[model samples]
Target: MTTFDDREKAFENMFAHDQEMQFRIQARRNRLLGEWAAAKMGLTPEETDAYAKAVVQADFEEAGDEDVIRKLMGDMTQAGIDIDEAGVRAALDEQQVIARRMFIEAQ
Candidate 1:
């Protein structure tokens, strides 16, 4: 193949890898966020695990983070937690950093 074709393939591969990593990081962040919320709600260990998985699944309902945020906000509110959207959003941001670091260390 020509040099241009090789470069194009390299870029495509990089894009795919980046997309996959972003998905992974976001999933991890969601799990962490769920665990955080679960603790706040005083869930049992088993319940926390299930709730974390549910939070990860919540991401699939929409294109952005709003779905997961809404699920968390609703669940927390129902459980009588006094947290607000800003707090959840802040936790989401913090968990994202931790998730990214975890992935990098795993590599």
Candidate 2:
């Protein structure tokens, strides 16, 4: 049987691990978004790197995932890309699926 202190330590470790995993997932998503935005912008190799970093920065600085999605959708619309909310949601969901698969594979 575990003591209260032991249980508390276990919970703390679990929380830390979970937080680390979430951070890694967010970083991966940011990198992927950066790459996609760079390609869409037709940036040169050097420019692509810079553009990608900007995209990731924009994503992190947003209020939340929804805000980031809205910004992306609005930008695409302004560029005549013809995407809607449902489309953006679907894309984000698909990306999440891909990220999960990649995480599993890495393990």
Superposition TM-score, candidate 2 onto the true structure: 0.74
Candidate 1 residue spans exceeding 4 A from truth: none
The global C-alpha lDDT for each of the candidates, from Candidate 1 onward, is 0.97, 0.69
Candidate with top lDDT is 1
TM-score of each: 0.97, 0.74
lDDT of 2 by residue, 1-107 (tens): 56988999999999999988876776566566656655665668897787556656767675567756766677677766766788777766676666667776898
Clashing pairs in 1: none
Give the clashing pairs for model 2: none
lDDT of 2: 0.69
Alpha-carbon deviation at 75 in model 2, angstroms: 2.5
